[model samples]
Target: MNLDFPTVMLIAAVITGMIWALDAWLWAPARREVAARKTASGGVSKADLKELNKEPVLVEYARSFFPIIIIVLVLRSFLVEPFRIPSGSMIPTLMVGDFILVNKFVYGIRLPVINKKIIDMGKPQRGDVAVFRYPKDPSVDYIKRVVGLPGDRIGYFNKTIYVNGKPVPQEIIGPYFQDEHPLSQSAELRIERLGNGEHQIVVEPGASLVEGQYIVPEGHYFMMGDNRDRSNDSRFWGVVPEENLVGKAFMVWMSWQWDQGGVIWDRIGESIQ
Candidate 1:
């Protein structure tokens, strides 16, 4: 089953908070009053009074966990959230097993679970590494570089990108090869300048890929993976709606190489472009 984590957390926080409040407002007071009456009548020992005032195990647990759950929910929903890169779609920029921090409020502030935007803070900019719900499947989160904003024309032809009839500048940085990554060894590393910033992109020479001009609709964005040909992006599916945006990925807090079975220490603390 596709578990909705945000919804689960919200539910847990509500249940725990209610239980704690109810116990304090109703149950605990009733217990103390009964204990006081018993002691005044000399019908209860100290041990009996203590037992009567004791809280239920469920209430105690609720009190302990309520604070923690509420904090996590608030931070994750409005501030920042951690995400694990699960695919090589963003390869060189964001590797598989890389744990990244996404700035939740960069694009806007949205409510938890339902993700309804309540405040406008900023908009996604071109060249930003973004995490968003997949247009084809909203249940899954996909990370990609913002290649085209709303109403912008994006073109991909022969491993090169064209923005508004102008070929985007690309400087070949020579061949890219990872000792443990056999599939990426043949790809060419290049610096592609998009918008006002530049980031590295990997493209296979002579590799056939989906090439065409795409016009981004209003309130939608075109996204592309840095791993050019290997990524499933707007070229294949469609533009990501503004509501599907999750956050802007800003840093790689941890990286684990599954194939090598070791931590990639160098990638840790690396800032995402």
Candidate 2:
């Protein structure tokens, strides 16, 4: 219902690849042989023979593109898949154009179209960045930092985060640059320490608390964006169910900013922390 562009592209690639394979292995070869025999006996004109030759053009293109599509689909559904940041939700850590790679099998390997989990690999760890289907709208994908696991109590007040009744430490680092949003014109860069992991985050002083305490239900997790002031995550829409878990975001493979034309080489190979 709420199918996004990526899902549609993947489906298209699969359908096209199947058609191509069928033609090559079953139909096209037979048709070609028939045409060849007709040509040898002078039963068909040159123009008709030319048209017959073009019958395999679609198959050829499909065969060529099948490998590329399969590679992407396998990587995206079972290994590591790349994604681009579209909003300021993960600002300090991931910019609007920052491209990231998510480890698809970290949680489990699921079939792409059906999204049915076929294996149990790992569970979400505290302080990990993750991608998942929006609980309210399954077709929409979202990325966020995992803060609370199942049965964990997460609290947010006065712009600070508290997990399991303990306060998470945050230290001011420096001023953050504003890009794509006017509200970020004067933001503070801060390092937030969660459990044993530390990550950079952006905060706006004197900003109101957008979310409050929540008890993460079983089989669900609480998530938040690094850009505390901008993300609409579990705090607003509710926890992400275990079934919605897609993958753990692990690295930035590439970045493309319309303002900056070609590849953003500097951001490449940067690990997701």
Candidate 3:
């Protein structure tokens, strides 16, 4: 079964917040009043009342974390959601272990859990690194760079990108670092200049070019990973429909290389362009 994390977070936040509020407003007040009455009647000593009136540690912790968790969940579902990079599909620009933030309402405002878009905000533009639900499997989310909008011709050949019968400019950068790993040694860095902006990309020169030409259909977009040689994107699966779009990734909040040990402090607060 595919677990819906946002739903789980929303439910947990509600349940915990309610429990905390109930304890604070109703149960705690009543308990304190009872203790005070007992003390006034001389049935309970001051020391005994003090001990009895103390809230449980678990309850105190729940009360504190409830509001914080609720705020985070709401912000994540409605404003921006944090996601960690799991693969090298967007290498050179977004490396594995990079934690990025996606703007939740960029494409449109959608109700959580139901995934029903209720507001029309804006369309995906060229050079955007977007996160979206996989068309083949709605439960799965995938990330890639937007290359073709609706009704545009997109072609990939010889490890180069062509849009609307014109080639997008790609300038070779220095050799990409391997980071003490065997798999990372295969790529070379290049910078792609799109209409909106410029970003880094990785390409494997000797790798076979999986060539294809696609005419983007209505309400759909053609997407490609920055790592041209190591990505399975629109060329392999298909174009992403408008409804499948989740959000536009706009920043890198954190990055941690587990093999290298500890947090990559430099990557924090870096804007995604």
Question: Highest TM-score, which number?
Answer: 1
Candidate 1, run of 10 with poorest lDDT: 177-186
Clashing pairs in 3: none
TM-score of 2: 0.82
Query: Please, what are the lDDT tens digits per residue for candidate 1 over residues 1-273?
Result: 666888999989999999999999999999999988888899687788889999999999999999999999999999999999998889789888899999999999999988999999999999999999998889999999999999998999989899889999999999987776545456899999998999998898867789899999999999999999899999999999999999999999999986777898999999999
lDDT of 3 by residue, 160-242 (tens): 88999999999987777675333445567888998779999888887786898999999999999988888989999999999
lDDT of 2 at 142: 93
- Least accurate 10 contiguous residues by lDDT in model 2: 177-186
Question: What are the RMSDs of all candidates, in order?
Answer: 1.3, 3.6, 3.3
lDDT tens digits, residue span 165-186, model 2? 8889999988887544446556
TM-score of 3: 0.81
For each candidate, the alpha-carbon lDDT, in order, equals 0.92, 0.85, 0.86
Tell me the number of clashing residue pairs for each predicted model. Answer: 0, 0, 0
Give me the candidate number with maximum lDDT. 1
